[model samples]
Target: MAYVDGFVIPVKVGDRQAFIDHARQMDAIMIEEGALRIVECWADDVPEGKQTDFHRSVDRQEGETVCFSWIEWPDKATRDAAFARMGQNEVMMKTPMPFDGKRMIFGGFEPIVLLEKANG
Candidate 1:
């Protein structure tokens, strides 16, 4: 029963290198803040429907693709405490953000089931 912070954001097209750099910085901050693991992903194969049909999201003047990322914390309390320090985190404050954070969709998820942790 760990805590998970999930997010889906839009990055500038053709800026893969910059995105990776940004993630590297973000990784450190998350780890320092007690994150167990961070998983960042780009929309390799988005399912067809409202997702691919997103209207006026972060971008997609003519319907572009998207990416997602998440961080795993020991528990909800840890996650909450860590996020509370975001305003004062030096790395979080110094790192350059490529996308508009306001436009991103993010939140905490209570996993109904985690298979990886289940198998002994």
Candidate 2:
């Protein structure tokens, strides 16, 4: 089964381009470190909730947009090893994040089921 690392971040509206540039750099590093693929999504229709929501979960402030992202790995072992390497990685250490790191939420998930459409 494939292993995945997922993230949700709140970025200021004015910083969108900066965030994309940052993500590009980070994605390259992750790919070099063994990530199979990286996917990033900018929220289009994220709705506010009365009780709990994506916005509320990240304590999103006014004029901020949510970014949903994920990195895919072949398996848990590779994912673990890559992350371990990232800890001491010089580029990662020096690269500044475009968004608030404290407010970002992230987790690792083992896919229980993934359905795909047949390609012609």
Candidate 3:
């Protein structure tokens, strides 16, 4: 089964383009380090909930937006190796993230279910 690393990030609403640019750079590094695919999504219709929500989960501020992202790997071992390699990557070390890294939430997951449409 494939492995996945998921993330919920809090980004400044005004830095949308900067965030994309940063993701583009960092995502390429992830790919080079062995990630199979990278998907980054900006908030569109996120709603405020009384108890909890995506925004509350990440402690999003008034001027920030929630971003959902994921990285796919062939397997857990590959993902682990890639992460180790990324830790020493020069570009990754030099590039600065546009969002507040401290507020970002991330975790590795083994998918329980996955579905895709036929290519037809």
lDDT values of the candidates?
Answer: 0.76, 0.92, 0.94
lDDT of 3 by residue, 1-120 (tens): 489999999999999999999999999988888889999999999999999999998999989999999999999999998888888988898888999899999999999899998998
- State model 3's lDDT: 0.94
Ranking by TM-score: 2, 3, 1
Model 1 poorest 10 in a row by lDDT: 54-63
Per-residue lDDT of model 1, residues 1-120, tens digit only: 588988778766666677778998888887888999998886777564664543245554333356688998999999899888977887788877876676777889978788764666
Report lDDT (Cα) of residue 46, candidate 3. Answer: 95
Task: Please give the distance, in angstroms, between residue 92's alpha carbon in candidate 1 and its true position after superposition.
Answer: 1.1
TM-score winner: 2
Question: Against the hidden reference, what TM-scores do the models get?
Answer: 0.81, 0.96, 0.95
Per-residue lDDT of model 2, residues 18-113, tens digit only? 999999998998999889999999999999889989998899998999999999999999999988999999888898988899999999999999
lDDT of residue 38 for candidate 1? 91
Candidate 1 accuracy as TM-score: 0.81
Give candidate 1 misplaced runs (Cα > 4 Å). Answer: 48-59, 62-64, 117-120
